[model samples]
Target: MSTIPTTAVAIEPLSISDRLSLVWRIPLLVIRCAANFASFCLSNGEIARLDWRQKLAHAYLRASRVTLTRKQQAQQRKLLTGPRIQGYCHRYNLEHRAVSVNNDTLYKKRDIPTPVLHFVKNPTTQPDGPTIFYLHGGGYHNPIKEQGHIPLALQFAAACKAKQVVFLEYSLSPEQQYPCQLIQAVAGLRYLLEQEAVQAENIVLVGDSAGGHLTASLLTHIVHPSPYAPPIDLRGRQLKAVLLVSPWMAMSEEQIKVLPRAPNDFLTRESIVRFSNMFKPGLNEVWSNRCDMHDAVAVWKKLFPTSHEHAICRKAMLAVGTSEVLLDSCVSFALECMGCETIYVNGQSDLRLVKEADFVLAIAPGEAHVQPGMDCALGYHDGKMMKAISTFLEAC
Candidate 1:
């Protein structure tokens, strides 16, 4: 087993100064929204492809991208922390607990605050049932949205009948870089095993976009220990499952630009590269190269060499929309997980054979990035894809 860190990092409260700064940006935000609307109107082809709901969501995300800087978004995220977040949980009748993790062994810098593990549980949740370790995705920069992320978490908990949901509030990028978020995640997982007494086999790692990238990073660290981070020992056990939603698997700018642009998808090449650089400054191609289609099989073999050492998990599901910008990479990664030969062709094929395999690939037709979760946040349930996800998790 990995050694747990001895020190704990405290959660810093947001100051009045931080809240005051946001008031001045309201006018600018309005201007940006108007500009985004004009751009949306001009893109007739893209608009034609999207449903009414997707069109509005795409517009909102685009405006948000321009209106708020990552730092501002980070500051706004502070409002959702502590008692505020707990209050939100109360509305759903879910219990909330905050656990601060020690980062003394994880980082040498004292300024980098320790990560927080937000434990949320439904009233009907079973004590010894499955536990979800959720990692929110915002390109490793933007703060989690109360309306979007909180509801999405509740949906997952309901879907799997989870005993508890552990959301890791890891440090954001530009301020904190690679291995910092990675190590903090390891620290959070350690807390689940050592403190909470949760079995490794009952833990499910669920992450969206960049969180999905972090989830994959954790798996790699398990197979080959990172010198910078503490190692975890599963005690001859494997995780219950891994569910990645619209994962940002590829980091290469050239590779990402080469992929066919999905008009309805909100992601852009420029935004992806900018976020990737913030997460890993002076970016090297070594990490991104591992995701290449030609090397996928070899990479998966190295990560999950044997059944006993199943660092990847006992079962896996990779869900991506047919209209996602990262569709190619997501599909490739899913194929690797299934240990199948990589197929480069565009439209869906025999990938549905995943129903018979331990690794499943779910494609949401006519949807955009992280569509199901986004839809859930909008109070739209009853999606066929989401039901499939619930069925998959229950079976696992």
Candidate 2:
């Protein structure tokens, strides 16, 4: 498919409030990281002792260096096209080659060509270790590469003593819609189980933002598929756990407008609508768009189909920052899930701590969307989220 041209928008000056938000964020991140490291030490003495201090330090330093502004985000949107994303992935590969044990690209070989899957195994870890199937988020239109995120993958692998990390580079929207990405995900899952000979019990599914939505779809399909949609035969397999970071699981154009704005949120209501439009057919175009013939919205409804039945994984963990715009939606989704209970950590009462008897919701105060991943690696409160994810995965 031909790449769609992205129109560049002129950078706009930040409002005074936005400027002050950025100024306050730097020190806040440092303070939060320190507080979180201390909390980890207190709460998880054994895991904390396993060289997380260095990881925490690295995350803090990185958090201080990268700050996203409206202008920068606008510029970023311009660079999310096919060729630019291809180049971005190339740069990621070049940059992370030194740390990666084995980095190979593989194709899913679907009817419609899907994006390449970047599989990076931990060089130091022994083979047949646990695997994390990671999906990066870019609102479904853009994708961040594994190179950008492999450090966190490595950190998880090291801390959990896991073996491999597979980053699925699924096809984006306006080019491929709905089931294309989902199909690619099932195919990738099949590869891990069948080709790599990895046991399903040792596999963990992790995704951020739109990637989280995809992950949710994959899990729900495995657990209870929509009768209307084509089934993904899991080959009698299941995953150990799932971790969703700021998942856009049940988003609506109406909900986006009503969501409370966060100081650090790069996602805008318009962007959400625009991205949704790419894969989700509008009321007027539902019949016209071939991808929507099977009804993607129906599939989404099936995925979230009553929070009560949403616990597809044996164990699940959700992390969202209190300051993120998606906090309410994420919390609501968690609360609706079966057997979920709310718990408070660190006296952050405003933070939603929804958990099923088996699920974990790690709410980081004053953090915003997708902070624990490579893009916001070492950002404030990320240490907290990472600590939560590590603890949950280890327990599972």
Candidate 3:
């Protein structure tokens, strides 16, 4: 049989003019606005670490424009399809060529390095080496955290004094969808189990946004096995703790609008549907154009059959802005997961010490879900979230 032509090949570009304002326009606009704002947020002091992305975003902004001034037009041309962007991307590759670590201790504070079993070396630490499985977030399709995040990951590993780290490079979307990414994450965990690096009790799973969602999903999966579940060989590795920051917990369109409105929110309502559709093809179509076959409002239910979240590993934290639509869903998912409890970190609510049972705390400063300084991402909160993570990594 002839291979079926993919919808992506047959469908038109996901443009701002597309209908179902939530699906394409919202995400595209937010991304563009974030890029444009990134242009504005650039500083000379941190030019090396930050300027390139700002420049890239600016370039994309320029490419996205129609008519422009000489400078603007020049910038767009350079950014849209130029060697400057390519050069920047190339430099990034060389820098990450060897992800080696300095053996010298940076500080002797309480840090937990739950090294991943797959990457651990026995220059020889006992089975007691700390283990942390990391998950990166980028609205399901974006995984370009090599620069701004790798350093932080290295530091996190060093802080934990872990021998190995499991950085999950989960699948991308527009093709792959719900449970798919979660399934891969579970597979990564099982990889650790197979390597015999650590046990469930020694493992600390860390994730931000979409990563967090997968972490939650993984936890949910193991606690409640499905026919689609991957076999778990938990002989040596014990799944201990989980940490999520501004996690994208809910897939329903109703929850997408929960996020606090910011100038450049990383996630928009429509993008949620776009990604949702990515998982369950025929899930939901961008409303900009009327799809005779899809509907975003109830599209989510049609995508994933499991509405009730399964309880898996115990929770360390599930932090989000009250303004974020996913907040309530995160809370509900944790609460519903029977055995799992969550630390409700509030961005718009009180940042007090919640009970630390199966629960934890938050430190939102009335900022957006993942704002720049507070968040490593353009609009997310990885920076501030790290503080919470350090506390968790040290606590137990």
Candidate 4:
């Protein structure tokens, strides 16, 4: 086999702020971890009375606040023009991994390229297995190269038993607008089918956060064509499944109030507004199509104005947190997937309900955006969460 190309980038030295954050955060995190362990050791009834859940939730919130505050400072510097900003880019890498360590190809706009990372248990000895076309989420701004993301991707690849995890690094936003990423996503999928010789049914499209929305949009296009966007020649390429993690389905201002914000949710309303505007800028064509949970069907109808591609009933899995702000929208979208009426989960409710339709819903309690995957990899969930995902992949 050909040697895997280097995709990992160089690791930068930790900044003062990073060290400061760690100095304080690490101790607190250790305390929280110990508390969590204690909670786990206790019986369910005893644990509830001891209120370990609340303690864990509060600890997470505190940590999230610290990270968010630091990130905001970095975001402000994003508008600056100087070596400082350049250094910041190099330091944060826009959350991408260093290009020095990875084996995936880096695609640029001119190349009509799609960055793909293949993970197998044994690269030299393994056989061709299932394909997971992973679209990562960063509100359309972050790339998969972010810290820990490569390992996270590998973890997902392992969980799903994929021989090759084709990560479609569609162009990021603000630099590339709405349909650009969508178009790139379609192109990437088609290229995988045509160039890679991967079968449609063997491929599972997986996405998280904004990536989930892109994955859903791509599905709509494949099953139902939109004249507004250029057509992709799918040629009846059906996928094994579409796994969405905390997908941001819609961006209505009204949604701000419709769903009560999670006390510990990391994403802020202001952050969402800022990024959404940055993504589309002046145009509302695709932005207007954002769903409100209940509008999943409507959004689908609008996107696929002609015949509905019923082939979307193939298989799907949506993993979301009960405490996530997008919980309502996810439920609504899940309802649409089941071809049933929308049912909104109350903000105060932490009920872990698993419903079956054309898709499966994996609800993690007291969790926020992308935490399950992160937690699973970091050993926060004790492998249970990853195992659940592995089971979902097997079922698919």
Candidate 5:
């Protein structure tokens, strides 16, 4: 996608007044978008009172046309200038167990297609178990910085006693756009499938926010290509499970209205709008062709470009916060998973409907938007969240 502005409307930096207008005006479009979105959250009685027409009208006022180029640049710059996120080392003083860490390959090479850096943690004997294909989230813009998500991955590795954990640093949004990110995700998973006789059922795809959305997308579009979807071989590449936190699954005019808009905290409606434009700065040409959610034929066509690949569906955990604006949509989307085996409940999700779900748990303190590890920074209760997640994964 080109970085040049498509509109000749004299591109000028937004000013205070201009931003104010945007703050008020943009909500209309978002609200309109939200109205059209399918509501799997409200029950038959609750939905009866839900005002669809009003939500639809409001979303229209805030929606902006998706741009092509500038979005890519913004996301790129943010990623380049972000802080060096470092995970806590397992150098035990009195907290967690102390273990010797050895991963000299950390930052050894950057040009590699996929870089798996090590996190500082007590080195437990590697367990003979399934592997985890970890995908970090950055709203399609930034990804887990070098060693950023290491702490979380290391914890999972210890609990599962897995042989290996591959952190696929897929190119972020904006620059990579839709297909590019999906391409790498598919390629990365496929690479693992080919390298070893790994059972598709043993591999878990883990992530949060945009990572969760990408996970859902991979399930929706990859196995079955839409008219606009690119070509990819998704044969025999199975997954054991999908673990997502506060995953941003569906994006449309309707869903945007109901998105969380808190600031400097979990998710904010305002920031989401801003970042939404920043990432995927341009629409994927492939998506334009077969992008039909409302159309039954289109959705069917979009979902399956080829014969059923027979990819065994994985058990999934879709966790969210109680106050999350996306709470409704997230749970709805989870239920719609073509072959969802299990759905673990989060406090946020339970606030809505609890159907076809296995278990529901309360939200931990200080738990903000979809964070996998390093909850201590946010003052979140680590033991409760992680223990529940691990238990759910182990049960299946």
Candidate 6:
């Protein structure tokens, strides 16, 4: 049996000097963006191939990436949280319930804020249908976007014909790190199972980017509990499905820099590195090098050690854009899940077997990082990727 890597490291908070450096870095980044824009106009490159809206979005993302530090991002999240929730309730005509999960012993010991499970009440949902537990992705530092994440979750709930969508508003990073978010996530699911009497088989765990990391972590924790987190036993229950959208699997800066760059992708290596550093501050070599969740086969094996032991889930879907910075890692993770021994570097056809494995890996052509979710958030649902996801969920 393969041993899971230990993540026992002290929390290293950013120093005063590191925070102050952002003042100078912001202006420098603006200047760099201006230069890049000039070059982009001159060359018929990848950026030129993108549609007008994509181009505009990419430019905005590049500018904002460096300007807003994690601290500022957290502050912005607080301001937007109230309005975003209210907007979703009004627009979707769904009832909102902010259920608190703070009674857990770990939370009280750590003095962590009560994590709120934002339940989106969908009246048309079938009582026996799946219940989605969504974890929004903002590199673990930013809050769930009103325009982006909420709509995307609702779109997924609609596609799956789920009864209701529950969003775990897990605590943000820098302010709260690593096991804290993981603990809150476990607590949220426990609340669903114990308090609400929701059966494990009826739940579908869905997350994108950093939220994807948390989702995977939750599964890992169930198989082998984390040292710092509160203990949780699934009672031999398995989830209906797990949907990982453009998951941020690679945690190290070295890993990020080594991956092939995607010119059209808005997510940058520097931004990812910064977010990762803030999320898991001081890490030992094992923890810093890779996220154990990337080894899907090992996780699956440990999760279902014997035939009598239940599998983690009945179905799993990993959706990634061809043009994402995290594309390579996502593909590697998919391959692991599919139990492929031989590597296929250039051949996309080999991945077709993924469907047969009960683990689907959907690749969106010419799209960039979580584009399906972004499109849904932006009120555009014509993408084939969205249809693929809906079909996968419907079949489940």
After TM-score superposition, the amount by which residue 366's alpha carbon in candidate 2 deviates from its true location, in angstroms, is: 0.9
Against the reference, the lDDT scores of all candidates come to 0.68, 0.57, 0.44, 0.54, 0.47, 0.69
Over 1-396, each residue of candidate 2 has an lDDT whose tens digit, in order, gives: 233332222345667887788778767778766765565455433324323543354345334435444343444444433444345436555222111111122223334454444555545564656778887788776646333354666566665566766777566676677666666676667667766677777888888888887787676556555332345555554567777888885455565667776534545566677777887733332221212335544543443344524434567777876656788878876665423444433432322233223565677654456656633344233355666665666566
lDDT minimum window of 10 residues, candidate 5: 1-10
lDDT tens readout by residue for model 6, 274-380: 88888883343222224444444465566534341356887778887667899898888666543322222122343334434456677766567877666765567
Assess the local accuracy of residue 203 in candidate 3 as a C-alpha lDDT between 0 and 100.
74
Put down candidate 3 lDDT per residue, 1-396, tens digits, no spaces: 011111111123333533344354445656765655564466332222333433344334333442222232222212111122123335544221112111123111212111111232222223455677777666665542543344344445554555555566444565445444555565567656654445677777777776666665565455344334455555433356666666665564444546444423334566566655655522232211112233332332221223323213333665554334455555554443322334434332322343334445453332234322233333332333455554455554
lDDT: which candidate is best?
6
- lDDT at residue 244 of model 1 (Cα atoms): 85
lDDT of 5 by residue, 1-396 (tens): 011110111224656775675567556646545643333123242222323432222222123332112432233334331122222332332122111111224212222122222222245625567777677676766546433355566566665666666655555544435555554555555555655556677777777677776665555555455432244454645466667766775465445766555321335565566557655522333232213335533443334222224433434566654435566566655444332333333443533322233333324232345534434222332333455565555554
How many steric overlaps are in each model, in order?
Answer: 0, 5, 39, 13, 26, 0
lDDT of 1 by residue, 232-275 (tens): 77777888888888888877666667777775577877778888
RMSD of 1: 5.9
Residue 324 C-alpha lDDT in model 1 = 80
Sort by lDDT, top down from the best: 6, 1, 2, 4, 5, 3
- Model 6: residue 53 alpha-carbon error in angstroms: 4.8
lDDT pick, better of 3 and 6:
6
- In model 3, what is the error at residue 273, expressed in angstroms? 2.1
lDDT of 2 at 214: 78
Query: Candidate 6's error at 38, in angstroms?
Result: 12
lDDT, candidate 4, equals: 0.54
Task: Give the Å shift of residue 290 in candidate 1.
Answer: 3.1
lDDT of 4 by residue, 63-154 (tens): 54554444433342232112222233356342222111121232333332233333323232125667777787777765453333444555
